[model samples]
Target chain A: MKILVTCKRVLDPYVKARVKADGTGVNLDNVKMAMNPFDEIAIEEAIRMREAGKADEIVAVSIGAAKTEETLRTALAMGADRAVHVVTEDDIEPLGVAKVLKSLVESEQPGLVIMGKQAIDGDSNQAGQMLAALLGWAQGTNVSNVELDGDTANITREIDGGLERLALKMPCVLTSDLRLNEPRYASLPNIMKAKKKPMDKKPIDELGVDTAPRQTLVSVSEPPPRAAGVKVASVDELVDKLKNEAQVI
Target chain B: MSILIIAEHDNAEIKGATLNTLTAAAKMGDSVDILIAGSGCSGAAEAAAALPGVRSVKLADSAEYANQLAENVAPLLVQLAGDYSHLVAPATTNGKNLMPRVAALLDVMAISDISDVVDADTFERPIYAGNVLSVIKSNDATKVITVRTTKFAAAEAAGGSASIDSIDGSGDTGLATFEGQDLTQSDRPELTSAKVVVSGGRGMQNGDNFAMLDELAGKLNAAVGASRAAVDAGFVPNDYQVGQTGKVVAPDLYIAIGISGAIQHLAGMKDSKTIVAINNDEEAPIFQVADYGLVMDLFDAVPQFTAALD
Candidate 1:
């Protein structure tokens, strides 16, 4: 009953990312990097699953450059038993990432895989579902609750209007959404122990997955800024502005 | 290019987001067909065919599609992939769940939540919570896309006489079973498409305080929304959330009461035509984007504001 979780190095959610002047991408040069917030929740869920005696071992996997090892270390510190880093300098798209994960899933044979619904950086929100499709496994995306019942997993997912509960067979994929759980901070002792944990690294090419780019990033630019307006002194002034000035009401 | 829009519906009527996705597909200047997949959904298929730019409607009626399960729906989409150059859906949670699987099965990459259709193969989408916009050019033979409904105008619901055809259904895939759902029952206008949106944040204090917003919204005929902090505090359900991860809304008038807007929350409503913030904290960031700011406690200003509407 081993569980596999994914972690990604991303620009910290707190910091506003600045687009490069040349319309290429965000300037990650010396920007604060941390494990994607949602992935932290995924790792935390896997740790809790093990703690509840639902599974035996937990493996944290990441795909990125060398900096991704730091993210995996953070996952290890949080409670993953080991780490796997697929080294690639290229910023792989969701399909490529899913393909690489599929390769790893074939080799690792974990019973379940938990991943962040979307990386706040790309906001693609595709890899987990794509991986499930490729593997012909059941998928629960944007899931807030997971209860494993022997070979079946009961999942509560966030949908457009409200919540939906589903019962999925084992060997499924679950993508963590907000409200899944509040992620815990790694203790100093746990961080030191993570430094000594087993971490396996492999080149992305070794996975034999086609890491080709299907989309060319044409440009990146800041969105049109909203102009600030004057402050109204009272609620009556606000209502008058809404009625006469803006004429929205 | 021929575009196949996967219609979002509940076997009763086509959702408004489907019309918005249709508008995005129509923007590509291609013939657009819609696929309506649900058990006993012929009514929806007929309605989909009535959309202004629809060329035809393909309906797959089966119990397997009742819940819109990704595994079952993706196979049906992949089965029909050969006839179209692009597969599109609105970026609702269901579409977001389904399209990637379809794209993966077709061995193509999906572009999610595109705010603009640059061309047949290019798109513009928001990244990092809409602070930055990225233009992308896809080289895939079959482009799979999910449209951000808030960004596009919805296609008109009528004026087309497209034919509706019954398509072969994709049977059950034994992978997942629908247990149940607890959708919030609301008679009010949907938050995303409402003319006015009234949202509260952590300043609202507790769940009981939302009654003030409810009364205000009732008078204004506006939808009620909550910030992530409010939802996280259990003051409201997740569906009440209005943010990047929640529902992106761009109503005509958006009133933020007691909401110290976070970047993610602002991303959802900054496109709104007229923004008003009511918070005691004059330095709240919500004021920066607001068209009119009122520095007053929500408990006082909300009731006064609601009374003024009378």
Candidate 2:
């Protein structure tokens, strides 16, 4: 069975992102960039399925600027067989990205498709579900475990306060949660081999999806700064502070 | 057009988050309706009717509602969603589970986790945790959205005039159930529904060190949480990981201890009404938006904090 995994390039989660001085967008000159943390889980899960013989081929796909090839290469280094780049220089919202993936899936026809539950940049968490909807496929999000039958996929998902299990008819979309899989590091050997792996590029223009924003972006601003307080010397002090100083209690 | 707020229930009681979504819907427009689709969930609809601002409550109860197995809830929502101009649900596993299919069925796109409603078509949401806010306006005639209840007030029990009505059941909707529920529990808050949260991270040093905040959390009647880094380092259970990869929360008071405030983790707690930080490094990112900040070593702070709380 062929497994498809999706990833995206996002500002490093650790970076204290600053909106551009001019407000055009975030200042990226010196900031770190990497594949979204959740998407890494997706890549790891697909590779694990392949290693387990549950998948015969793993195709890692990313849709973003040309710089995203680095992310696709990272996925290949981690163990995907090849990569597909859905190119877009400008940012594309979740719906447009899903539209592009849906069209690509129609042609690729992988048995299973997996993605991170949401991206760190936008945290939309909608692309996988939207793709599932557009393709008439079943979907499971926040998946902790996946069990596949001949033509059905049984996925255990994380829910509020507990877990729920559902069976989806293949082909299906599954979004990985934090506990789904631990991503493996790219070794020196794998990193070298990744450079030799096949990588293809396609554009949202070719896939026939709207790359336009549905909503206007009026502004992007950093949240306000936190307030200040000091350490209390004792539990009694803490209680006194809660009731008297902060008065939160 | 009217808005549709999906009722959350397990054939037992309505989830608090569902009413939280109602609070968000109340902000959107004049008319709000709650949709309850499950097997024998008319009672759930009756319960939902108790929320304020609901014009009516609709239920399509059947055995199918029990599972919330998307295939069933998807079609049920799509059939009912046609009349409403806007669709909103609390961004839960259930709402996140079914709303996309409804969006797919309607062949329209949806905006998820809006922190604020701008107009009928525009909204504000946090993308990189709470670090960066994105204000988006939807062009779709029919808007579908899942609300971040943390951003909206919980629906008040002040009472409303809505009535619950039982609709014809749609039976089974073709989705299959494979596994049942088995949960992992934590001594802290459930994350999404916590009124107060005290989270720690790598700066906490070790697993046992989390107790510093544990005492404080218990005293606050809040949940204990952890950043992804803390959880990944085995300082805490995965259930405590808060960020894009972990849980997203909005609590009344959030105290982040010894956490450097990665944008990912900050995204989870940025919506808290009051944010208190304990970091030795004054430059720690977690201090950026903390309502209260302490630039002191956690070692000195934790004991002092625990002593004060207990």
Question: What lDDT does each candidate get?
Answer: 0.93, 0.79
Interface RMSD of 2: 3.0
Candidates in order, TM-scores: namely: 0.99, 0.90
What is the per-residue lDDT of model 1 for residues B1-310, given as tens digits with 9 covering 90 to 100?
9999999899999999998998899888569999999999989998998888788899999899998899899999989999999999999999999999999999999999999998999999999999999999999999999999989988899998899988988799999999999999887899988999999999999999999999999998999999999998999889999988888999999999889989889878999999999999999999999999999988889989889988
Docking class of 2: medium
In model 2, chain B matches the true chain B with a TM-score of 0.88
The residue-by-residue lDDT of candidate 1 on A1-249, one tens digit each, is: 999999999999888889887767899999899999889999999999999999999999999998899999999999999999999999999999999999999999999999999999888999999999999999999899999999999999988799999999989999998889999999999999999999999999988889899999899999878887889999899989999999998
DockQ of each: 0.91, 0.52
Candidate 1, clashing residue pairs? none
Tell me, what's the RMSD of every candidate?
Answer: 0.8, 2.9
